[model samples]
Target: MAKAQDKEAKAAAKKARKQASKERRQQLWQAFQMQRKEDKRLIPYMVGLFVLIVAIFVGLGLLFGSVWLLLPLGIVLGLLAAFILFGRRVQRTVYTRAEGQPGAAGWALGNMRGQWRVKQAVSGNAHLDAVHRVIGKPGVILVGEGSATRVKPLLAQEKKKAARVVGDTPIYEIVVGNDDGQIPLNKLERHINKLPKNIDGKRMETLEGRLSALGGRNPQGPGMPKGPMPGNAKVRGMQRTARRKG
Candidate 1:
């Protein structure tokens, strides 16, 4: 009986969270629609697509005479798949709008959906070239977007800085653009979030605590220009590359 009650409670909480997320997505879509006059038609199509996918999955399970459990399972899986496509379309639209604009990365990140904890303009240039670090169990992800040459230096410097406070934590870096090595903007967040978590929740909290003393703002340049270069921020990558070429 207790187990049953616990299951019931869990189900209720999950439903509540889903409803809240839907409401938030609706509000966000509505706001996006206002500013994006062209996307107004997409709202209904997006909904209809999801509904159609769900109906098909349900019909398939019934027609195939699958196990009773497959009905709900298929419906859920189908909806997830449809929404994922829906989400990608939304991202592509945003990426299109933000293309080549100053601070485009900042805006793309700022408007990211769901509960991603992102710090904006973390460390960036006036031209909107920037590096954003997101810390979680997936370890330290250093995302750099700008000139490949410039961003590499920034990535190395910040990695060093993060290491001082992060100890032996895992660090990953990627440049965002259409370069030979860059990850496309459409799939950036999914790629980051799907990485294996290296640090546990507690360690992340500790690392964040240590990182707070570094700089309130990640600064556009090496030292934030406004604060002391924490024990970790180093700019050696650029220097070494220069020497190698020279």
Candidate 2:
């Protein structure tokens, strides 16, 4: 009986150890994946970073071969690595915190692969929210993810904005959710991409010409209501919309 009890205790310890090891490995994997994902230009960027770092150190080391510069430089490099690590940690934390929240779609869409004009929170009401429009071949797509009763009105307002520039361009509106009338959050982008392209260069050029006057405004408000701020439009085609709320 004592021997069986001891065996069970050993087994439990081993199991716990295995679990800890697995968890550590999973954390490392997640960290690595996050780093890789955020840095699509990983190789070149890192190489450039490393080269610059090495050059600085080489010059500094030559200038002051004494312990003071070397030690300080080592500390700086260590801190830089820590900063990179911390940045990724912050990003993952922000993402984890945003999961299942109201405006998660904004985060996902802003992080897409192309030059999309994402105007966020174009219109919002007590019960619904509307993301503003414009895209490349994708044309105008109003994305609403809130109560259907409220979203419809939000959609109408957004549609009106699109029509002013979209003219006869193919326009689509979709609500993000699993409800009977909504598109699931995960499928939102795929559905948008899968839609037929509606605008030609001539029309797109004309649309841009019309909307050019509307680009001087700021897209980001104080803090975005419930989810991610559209980051890429600043880098991508997301210029400011001229319209402002009174």
Candidate 3:
């Protein structure tokens, strides 16, 4: 009787998970539809991707004389291509919306893969200009967003404070914007990823601990949300879908 009851409970849990997954997919589909209304190129891009994949696979099959074997492979590749293109579009849309918004730099850092520790709104002023700090294998990275003239001083001050605590640890600075000498919002993640990894995992943990002791923004100052901003849920949804598909 105990075993039978256990099986029933397991079945119920499985059914609940299936329902949750179905709902999530429905939500993603609805989000995609709404995005398509603004992204006029989405359908055309998918159609072009399908046509290109079919052409390449059909050509290879003709040369190999394995048309049947390659036909299904072609369909699979086409679908994968469509999915990737969709993800890219979603990412672009997210960045476009996030650009110039307060806390966007922190949001981007939070979404990055790996073991980096992010502290949002470490320093800011009434103008909405802010500095966010990230601790990773590369050491401390200070990212500033908002007016270059104002943010330069904020980043400098934060760097000095961080330097006092993390002696000899390499500190890299980045400004997020489209202006000269600034990294574009879309390329921010790639830029950080390319930085030289100066420290190992153990050292990274040590550095994170030291910075944590320094604490974050002043309790009296305004704070930006640590997660992605509103209307950017679709980007997170796309990331989830890609992870599951992978």
- Per-residue accuracy of model 3 over 1-246 as CA lDDT, tens digit each: 999999999999999999999987886686578668979999899889988998889889999998888989998999889878877777777778877778788888888878888888888887778889999888899999989998999899899889998889999999999999999988999999999898888888888888888877745456666655646566666656544543
Give the 10-residue window scoring lowest on summed lDDT in candidate 3.
237-246
Per residue, candidate 2 scores C-alpha lDDT tens digits across 109-214 of 6654455666666666544254545465767677776567776876786677667766677777887777887876656667777878766666666766665545
Residue range with the least summed lDDT across 10 consecutive positions in model 1: 226-235
Name the runs in model 3 displaced over 4 angstroms. 218-221, 225-246
| Runs in model 1 lying further than 4 Å from the true structure | 1-88, 110-117, 217-246
Cα lDDT tens digits, model 1, 127-226, are 4467776776777777787777776776787788878887888888877787777887656766776788777778877877776656744555442222
By lDDT, the better pick of 1 and 2 is 1
TM-score result, candidate 2: 0.48
Which residue pairs of candidate 1 clash? 137-197, 161-232
CA lDDT, every prediction? 0.61, 0.58, 0.83
Candidates arranged by lDDT, highest first: 3, 1, 2
Q: After superposition, how far is residue 58 of candidate 1 from its true place, in Å?
A: 9.1
